[model samples]
Target: MKELNSIPIENIYYMLCYSWDKLDYISRNKIGIEESMDIQNLLCRILVDEVDILIKKGIKKNYKELNESSSVVKGKINFKESIKYKSTKQCKVNHSYDELNENIIINIVIKTTLINLIKIEDLSISNRNKVKRLIKYFNFIDTILLNKKIFKNISFNKMNREYKFIINICELIFDNLLINKNDNSAEFYNFIEDERKMAYLFESFIRNFYKKELKGAKVYREDIYWELTGEFVEFLPKMQTDISLEYNDKKYLIDAKYYKKSLVENYGSKKLISGNLYQIFSYLKNNESKSKKDEFSTGILLYPRVDKTLDLEYSMDKHNINIYTVNLNSKWNEISKRLISLIK
Candidate 1:
């Protein structure tokens, strides 16, 4: 069997920032995510640190279901449900209590998942300190909901706004909690082998960066409508761009492509993928009518930097298109400069 590679934990942060639309999380708390650290340890550290801070300020409190005999009752008393069965027929009025909130439910779920991961031999092979600290954090949490059910469909609002990062992290953890039949070291590796997912992350990271950092240019994901009208148009698929930039009467449609091998062999010659070129061409053709200054409208097919440097540009009657690559492995300043320079 061949050894499989794991997705870096930093990439997961990038994924989270874009998927959750939490641009500030990565920018604010940039610590604890190092490329040298194992992903499992990184996740544990995130849980511990985020939860510890909340614990210091005190756990977020909300009104939860509580039914017991109290002198004063705040919420509506469930008399029928509470008095249905009593071991002793004692004169005790049951009142629905509104004690602490269910915000700790997030902590309970995270800690339980951490416990399960600790038992797995595949993921538990490294960073003993992380394991010990996870256990301590698990023990520190007082509310222990033994149910190992993952919250797949959670709705977020202002009440739980601060816990968004924690909730999203737990979502990623739950997706990775596949049942282990035997002690296979490759299980963790196999779980993260989806290149399509990585591609989407790479695309979204670029889009969000433009939306946040671009000063004068307006950046957004543009939806290109089909030129044809009739039943065929309704049946056709949606043409959605990864990112688009518009400024000073010029518009640039950018599509981000991700792959391990940047070059594709064509007719015994190395070149960019033909299908990508076709797709970008089609997008430009269908949307040319909407451009105010078609002469300045441009299209870009962007790819992550691989082994070779491939940059090409072409200009037609009213449209200019280019194929460019960005190196994500470079320093933050360099990456930012390269992307921001696109507008110029």
Candidate 2:
């Protein structure tokens, strides 16, 4: 994969927006795209702009259950607590009620992310000031101890759909940031060096890009079942494809890989990664066996260009397997064209 430091900051921004399905927002806002900035500054700019837009539209409010002692009865009355506290003497009652407020989970997440961003020394002074300014708008929102588990409890519906893009940005920021417990400081690490996180972003970017740009073809991730007749087949793990495109009765199963080196050295000779090849091959054969129609199936192992370019093709058992690389260091327009041309 192209090193994060070498890739243009604007290209990384575009990839992130595409992965989050916020291309429309980014295009309309056009925030800080022309500036010569690093990844931290670019992300901070986008976050500030998006949060400013959201504030203008009014932050979302959800009904949260509140439990307290009050003179007025609401929702459900807790008689035991009321009696225990001797409410009759004070003329107050204990009750649990739902109140509409801005202290929802999504808002809290955004607030926490902004606070953390301000602590990162890598961000430009201007970007840090912008983040500080945006923090004032979230005064009503509560801040919580942010963790990966907190994200799992969040769900989006029609009412909160607008928050999805912002929340995704917050999640990305959280993933790349490391917190210090001693002094409560945060450090922003270069995401390119983090293989696991970059792998996910690369995969999502490819899938969403294909879904948006490709026409006359249905794009989706598919689960391929093994073509076996044994009763103990439950022991086998499920085979899932990263990107599956179907057009003209043909299926293209793509496996997107993000690695520091596209080719590995073996005995002083560069060679294709054996494990990746085997995995894609298994996907193609099993998927082909399950189909009853005479449809042609192809497997593609797509990776980001690293040191050199690679475009190799192979055919086995009437199935075609292609290994291609997309250079992220190129211009955005060229990169987009190259990606679309791969399956075409």
Candidate 3:
């Protein structure tokens, strides 16, 4: 329970000792400010995250054990056992972990904690494994799925592949921060937050994933054009607004949605999206006014691929105004090949 901010200024030497303690005394004092600062920051993050995982895990574990045994005896809280507050004079680390602890972890406290983790290598691995698994599982799910609920299933091979891109970066963190075979509930809870962050980061590449690979240079206004689906004024009265586009001579009105595949089945199959149909129906009604002598004026809803549908089409307006689904999941080559098959 010592205040991290008020650590003994004398303990600064302990930090310095631990830093170069890995190296000889000559190398210790010779460390650069930048390198030392880096080590110090890394140590701080590791320390802070540790205290967070440990305290939370220990409390919950004690409670579960108490209830299971049907004992009313109160468990002792060892404040001294908790080195949540510690300080350092030297350290180094790489990427920063966003502090997801319920409490705002003090910077100094975190540094102190990391120092102790190294000092007590003989300490129980139970807490260490908890911390490591929590970090790894979270970072993994967040990298690929990025959904808050994505942690419900981690055993799938598809989800596991996402770890390959991140392994090189996380190798050091896993080794230093985790006690791998330990059971820790606090670590599990923390995984949810970690998963959310990683998944968000992974999906940030949505635009990059579907980038266009033009065969020849695309003309500024030729390959794709925003040909008005209907006169802007007339398109407005059909329970909707127009502003529809004609991409590559396809007479259609398009709306963009970033729906994942899971939502597609739940919403589209259960008949929950009747209004969506009406909205698109309006687009067709308006755009139909602009149809050429041959082709139909269609309404298209563009979305990211989920179940890998091979251009599934649903009929409306007696099969005259067709609504088609497009895939956003495959590699550019596969997608382009599928697109050729779809357009015809």
RMSD of each: 4.6, 2.2, 22.3
Sliding window of 10 residues with minimal summed lDDT for model 1: 184-193
Give the lDDT of residue 291 in candidate 1: 60
lDDT of 1 by residue, 1-344 (tens): 01113445565556557656786656667565677766555665566566656656655656667667744555777677557535566555567756775446766666666565565454535444555565574564553433325475455688766677776666655555554547622223333356776677678788877777776778888788888878666789899888888867788889988776667888898877888888888788888887675335788988777665567889876778898777665565676788777667
TM-score computed on alpha carbons, candidate 2 = 0.92
Residue pairs in candidate 1 whose N, alpha carbon or C atoms collide under 3 angstroms: 62-101, 66-97
- Cα lDDT tens digits, model 2, 1-344, are 33644777777888888888877976698575754776667777878888998999999998999999878888899988899668448877889999998998899999999999988877788888889998998998889888999887889999988888888778878988888878877788778667887899889999999888888888899998887879899999999999998866778899999888879999999999999999998887777756742135888999889888898999887788999999988899999999888877
Model 1 segments more than 4 A misplaced? 1-35, 68-95, 102-104, 120-152, 177-187, 190-193, 291-296
Residue 254's lDDT in candidate 1: 90
Question: Between candidates 1 and 2, which one is better according to TM-score?
Answer: 2
TM-scores across all candidates? Answer: 0.78, 0.92, 0.28
Identify the candidate with maximal TM-score: 2
**Over 4 Å off in model 2, which ranges?**
1-5, 34-36, 72-75, 292-295
lDDT of 3 by residue, 1-344 (tens): 11222222222222333222221322423322232233223333333343454444531110122111111223443333222322322221112223233222122222223333433344335444534544432221212212223222322245233222222112222223433335421111111124343233223222212222222212121122223466564543424322233345544444434333213345346332455566666555544534472136555554434444433467665324333344433343454464344334
Clashes of 2: 0
**Ten residues in sequence with the least summed lDDT for candidate 3:** 59-68
